[model samples]
Target: MGWALAGRARSTDEQVLELLEPYAGNRHRICRLIRLAGARAARFGPRLAPQEHRFH
Candidate 1:
């Protein structure tokens, strides 16, 4: 089966940041999660959209 790793995440900013750090180039597992988080936050909360747009 294909790996749908979108839902796998810890419950902390630092932890999420740490995971995404290695994918700073926007091409890795952690990076994808970061993108998903941003979209979700923006869809549910406008304030966080600006922060998420910075990466993409």
Candidate 2:
């Protein structure tokens, strides 16, 4: 899932949302992953700017 998310983060226009879409019903998991990804991105830097829709 990590590799897929990393690839999708760089490969797709949607960034992380495409990977998280299947878990839309699980808000906690979605937020957890987003935080985790943000932390990782903070350490390594983001490949792209995340979309604003995520915080909505």
Candidate 3:
């Protein structure tokens, strides 16, 4: 999955907001959700990789 994005260009903040706008209520709420998701990933993502490798 990471490889899929390796060659892709990153979207700007505005583009991200636009893309998520339909599913999300508004810009502020979307930004908050993004922030919370980022924080959760930062905290737990590292631990997940090793566990995933073990399962595979």
Candidate 4:
């Protein structure tokens, strides 16, 4: 799968997020989103709710 992604020029992060999108509104998503948002927030300043940054 890793090789396939490299061959296709696909981002692993995008693949992971795509898999997670179907479970949106679930706690799993909440946690993932929180983590992502936290990292971005650290750089940009100010925290945002997970919903503010959808997986699209």
- Residues 1-56 of candidate 2 have per-residue lDDT tens digits of 33445642244446556666778798567667757776333246558876687654
Worst 10 residues of 1 by lDDT: 1-10
Report the C-alpha displacement of residue 11, candidate 4, in angstroms.
7.1
Candidate 3: regions farther than 4 A off = 1-9, 39-56
Better of 1 and 4 by lDDT: 4
lDDT of 1 by residue, 1-56 (tens): 01222354334655555555656776465555646665442124346434454555
TM-score of 1: 0.30
Runs of candidate 1 exceeding 4 Å displacement: 1-9, 27-56
**What is the total number of backbone clashes in candidate 4?**
0
Q: How many clashes (backbone N, Cα, C below 3 Å) per candidate?
A: 0, 0, 0, 0
Candidate 4 Cα RMSD (Å):
16.3
Expressed as tens digits, the lDDT of each residue in 1-56 for candidate 4 is 22222333334766655655656668475556657654322134588666755566
Q: For candidate 3, lDDT tens digit of each residue in 1-56?
A: 11121222455666655566665657567556656665322122334343354544
Question: Which pairs of residues collide in candidate 4?
Answer: none
Residue pairs in collision within model 1: none
